[model samples]
Target: MSYLDPETSKKLVPIGRFMGEHFTGGNWTELGFLTGCDSIVQNHPRLLRSLSFGDDDYPEACLAVVGSMVRNDPDNLKLIEDYIIEHFSESGPNISTIPGLGPTIRFSPTVFKVPTHPQDAKLVAVMMPFGPSFAGVYEAIKSACSQTQWFYAQRADDIWKDTTIIQDVFDLIFRSQIVVCDYTGRNPNVFYEAGIAHTLGKTVIPITQNSADVPSDVMHHRYLTYLNNGEGLNHLTLTLAQRLRTLDPTLAQFA
Candidate 1:
C-alpha cells in the first residue's frame, strides 16, 4: 500500500521534484520516510499533537501505516531508523519486533541544547555586496523598515576576517528570519547564499535591477523587479516593506 493517498501524493510531487533536483546525493528512501512522517503530521494533526506530547503509542501506530509502504525495502527501514536517530541527537527511537508483524518503531523524546543569541538582534539579513550601484537600494530598504526596528545588514559590513567568509555567510543565513537577496549582475556568491537560505527554510526575498538577472530555476518564486534609479528604488522599498508586513504583522504599526 502507498504511504500517501493519490491526492496527498500529487500534492507532494513538487516537493519531491525540488528535493531530487537539488539534493542529488540524498537517499530517496530516507526522503520518502521523512515525507511520510510529514504527511501524517499535516493530515492527522491530532495524532501528531499526541506524538509531540510524548505519547508512547501514537508513533507506533503511525509507523505501522508508514511501514506498509516500505516494508519490502529493508535498506530503507534501516535508513529511516538511522535518520530518526541522527536527527534526534543519536538517542534512537524505541524499537521492537513482533512475530509475523515485523518491527515496530516508537517515538522517544530527546533533549538537545540550542545556543542562544543576543536579544533584539537583527532578524533580516541582506545578501548583497556593498557597491555604488547597490547603495540606493540598501538605503531605501532601511528607510522603509525604520519603524519596525528591524536591523538591516549586509555580510561585508558585519563579518570579521578571523572567521571564514563562507562559514559566516552560512551562520548569517541560519540565524536570520528572512534573507533579502539582490541578484543584480547575477552574482555567483549571492546565488550560492540564496540556495543555502532556501535549503535552511528561511524566507528569501529575491530582488533585482534587471529581470533577466533572476535565474530560470528560481524565476517561479516571486521577486521584486526595479530599475537602477531613484524612482525604482522608492517603489522597491515600499513593496518590500509591504511584503515584510505580510510576514510580520507587528511591522504594520511601522507603516
Candidate 2:
C-alpha cells in the first residue's frame, strides 16, 4: 500500500533493512520517500546518505530514523517491497512460503505481493528424517494440510535446487512460516533441522512417536505423539489440521 498504518509499519521496519541490503546493487538513496515522508527525508538527507553508503552494520540511529519515515507515510513501502519480491523471485521464487502478519509469526504480508503462492496457501515446512519408515507419517501431515484448505505441507526431499541438500533445507526453513519437526526416530538430522527452524523464529510444531525420543534440552516445547499405524495416523491428521488452522488464521476459513 502507498500508505500503511502503525501496526503494519511496526512489522515492516525490521525487515526493511534486510530488503534494502539484499536487493542486489540497490542503494537506499534511490528509495522513494512516502507521501508524508518527503519533508523528513528532505530535512535530513544525511540519514538516507548514510544508509546508502554506510557499512553493512548500519547505525541504529539511522535505522530508527528510517523506521520513523516508514511510520510517517510509507508511500514507497510498496515500491521497495516489490523490488524485494522481484529480486527474491528471480528464479521462479526464492521465497517459497506465503508472507503474513501477527505476533506469533515472521512477516507482515499486508502490502507485499509475495508471488510463490498467489493462491495464498501458507506453506508448512516439515523437518523429518528422510527414510521410508516415516513415509506414512509424512502422508498424514499432507492430509492434514488438505483439511485446512489453504495450508500445504512440504518436506526438504519434496524440492531440490542445490546439490548440497543442507542448503535446500536451509532455504525451505527460511521461507516457511511454520515448521513441523518430527523426532520419531530421534534422528540426528531431524534434531539438527529442528534447531535451525527454532533459531529462525519460525513457529515450530514438534511431533514424535515416543516422548522419550525427544531431546532433554527441548522438552519444554509441547509435542504431538502419534503411532505410525493406520488408526494412529488417522488421528494424527485431525490433530495436525486443527493445529495448522490455528497457526495461520488469515486463510483459515475453516477456523
Top-scoring candidate (lDDT): 2
Put down candidate 2 lDDT per residue, 33-142, tens digits, no spaces: 42355555546645555556765544553455456665554434444444455545433322323232222323533322333433223778899887788899999999
TM-score of 1: 0.52
After aligning candidate 1 to the native by TM-score, how far in Å is the CA of 206 from where it should be?
0.4
Q: Compared with the true structure, what per-residue lDDT tens digits does model 1 show for residues 194-238?
A: 886775556788999888999999999999988778898889878
Superposed on all Cα atoms, the candidates' RMSDs to the truth, in angstroms, are 14.4, 10.2
Q: Model 2 misses residue 166 by how many Å?
A: 0.3
Candidate 1 Cα misplacement greater than 4 A, ranges: 1-122, 249-255
Q: For each candidate in the order shown, give its overall lDDT on alpha carbons.
A: 0.57, 0.66
TM per prediction? 0.52, 0.56
